[model samples]
Target chain A: QQPVQSPQAVILREGEDAVINCSSSKALYSVHWYRQKHGEAPVFLMILLKGGEQKGHEKISASFNEKKQQSSLYLTASQLSYSGTYFCGTELIFGNEKLTFGTGTRLTIIP
Target chain B: DAGVTQSPTHLIKTRGQQVTLRCSPKSGHDTVSWYQQALGQGPQFIFQYYEEEERQRGNFPDRFSGHQFPNYSSELNVNALLLGDSALYLCASSRQQISGNTIYFGEGSWLTVV
Candidate 1:
């Protein structure tokens, strides 16, 4: 099943912050975060495994909550370059190599 | 290192026709996965190939098939296509067994079914 993402859209000014959330009904073995600019392919950001851990990339950090079947992506001090669509791909527990993606959250950063 | 590469940046086809898209995995990567992305929607998994065999597949129908060569390059073939199949087809590559490994995606092949 496809994952659910909160806040279909968000706008932030430079130096501001925003958060995107992804939730799935099924247990996830991993959560992969990616960003896609208009007319471009999605770029990998980070992957959070099933242990409910967190990882950071520059000012962007993500946390995985295994028990909650959710993951949250935090963009701190957002920059204009951060304007793009963010997606979370969920890997299920059954060894299905396919990753189910969330609808996505569109983020715009203004200077 | 070269990342995933896809062919035919854009293509147009008639309904009921067949189409084949190609992909070359990232350097040293042995697994390739195919995805379909409709406009304004996230990508949906089609299938995955590893070691020249299909290891996993999504809910896609039999009309959607794929093959991975010994060199780890892959091809996605769609037979009896429908207008609904008109979308951006993405190819992602990663190392086999590298759980949680970041899958690298290609620019994608945009297909327009008429």
Candidate 2:
């Protein structure tokens, strides 16, 4: 099942912060974050496992709450290059190898 | 190292026709997965291949099929294409053990059905 993302779209000024949320009805084993610029492929940001771990990549970081079946991505001091669509990919079961992505949250960063 | 690579960066086909897309996974990766991404949407998994066999599949219909070769390359074939079939087909690759592993995606093949 596809996950639901909050704030379908967001506009942020450079040096500002923003958060994107992803909620799934199904229990999750792992949560992956990715960003795709216009006309490019989805690029991996980080992954959070079932242990409720938090991982960071540069200015971007994410937290996975297994109990809540949700994950949130935090973009600190957003940059112009941060403009793109952010998607959360969830794995219902470990080793199942299938990742169901969320609808996506469009993030726009302006100078 | 080269990441996942897809063929026919763009294509156009008529409704009711068929089309095939190809993908070569990243180096040192053994498992391949295919996903369909429509405009303004996230990628949806279609199927996964491991050891040259179909290891997993998503909610896609039977009209959508795929094959994986020993070299870990894969193909996605769609029959009786419809306007809705127009989307970007992405090929992702990772280790056979997938869980917790980073899956890399290709540039994707864009298909347009008239």
Candidate 3:
């Protein structure tokens, strides 16, 4: 089954902060964060492997829960360039690299 | 490197027609995976090819098929397409590994079925 993402969409002003959450009923091996602009493929943001793992890039960071079935992406000091949809992909700890992505969170950063 | 490259960036076809989208994996990569994304949803995995063979598949129908060439390039073929088949077709490439690995994607082929 696909993972569930909270807050279908968010609108923010430049430098504001936002959090997007993803949860899966099944166990997850890894949680991958990606951002996709309009009419473009998703770009890798960061990946959290072990439980309680937290990773960051620039002002963006994400945390995987202790159960390994949940993740949250934190966007801080957001810029207008952050306008896009964010997706969290879940991977099995032991299997092929096929990823199941969440519904996605649409973030619009206004200047 | 060129990352990943796809052909026929945009195309329109009828409901009963067929279409072929191509992709070339990045250098030093031997695995290719295809995904389908609708207007607002996240990408849905279709299949993955490795060593010129289909090693894994998603819940997609048989009408959705693909092949990997000797040069590590791949083609996604949809036969007897339906209106619901209209979506952005994405091709991703990554190196094969025992555990999960990062995959890079092409720009994607946008398909419109009329």
Candidate 4:
């Protein structure tokens, strides 16, 4: 099943911060975060495995809640380059090695 | 190493026509996955190929088929295309154990069905 993302879209100032959430009805084995610029491919940000662990890269970080079957991506001090569409991909324990993605969240950073 | 590469960056086809898109996996990668992303939506898994075999598939229709070559290159073929099939087709590649790890995606081929 595909995951559900919150705040379909968000607008933030250059220095503002935001958090995007991804939740699924099925138990997830791992969660992946990717950002896609306009007319560009989706770029991998980071991944969060089961066990409710958190991983971060630069100003982008993500946390996975195994019990809740949800994950969240936190963008700290967002920059102009962070403007793009963010997608959360989920891999379920019973899924057949196929990663399903959420609807997507559009993040627009302005000066 | 070169990342995932896709051919025919853009194309236009008529309804009932057939189309084929090609993809070459990254160096040293043995797995290839195909995805279709509609406007304003996330990428939807089409199918996955590993070891020159179809390992996994999504909920796509029977009209959608794919093949992987011995060189790790892949091709996605859609027969009797419909207008709704117009979207960006992306190819992703990873290692053998594609359980949960980084999967690189290509720039994608924009297919337009009239």
Q: What is candidate 4's lDDT per residue for B1-114, written digit by digit as tens? A: 899999999999999999999999989888899999998889999999998999989999999999999999999999999999999999998773544566789999999999
Candidate chain B TM-scores, in order: 0.96, 0.95, 0.96, 0.96
* lDDT tens digits by residue: candidate 1, B1-114: 888999989999999999999999899888899999999999999999988999988889999999999999999999999999999999999873545666889999999999
Against the true structure, what is every candidate's RMSD? 1.4, 1.3, 1.5, 1.6
Weakest 10 consecutive residues, lDDT, candidate 4 chain B? Answer: B94-103
Global CA lDDT of candidate 2, please?
A: 0.91
The true-structure Cα RMSD of candidate 2 reads: 1.3
Give TM-scores of chain A for all candidates.
Answer: 0.96, 0.97, 0.95, 0.95
Best by lDDT: 1
Q: What does the TM-score come to for chain B in model 4?
A: 0.96
Candidate 4 residues A1-111, lDDT tens each?
789999899999999999999999998888889999988899989878888989889998999999999999999999999999999988775334467999999999999
Interface RMSD of 3: 1.5
lDDT of each: 0.92, 0.91, 0.91, 0.91
lDDT of 2 by residue, B17-50 (tens): 9999999999998989999999998999999999
Candidate 4 Cα misplacement greater than 4 A, ranges: A94-97, B96-99
Clashing pairs in 1: none
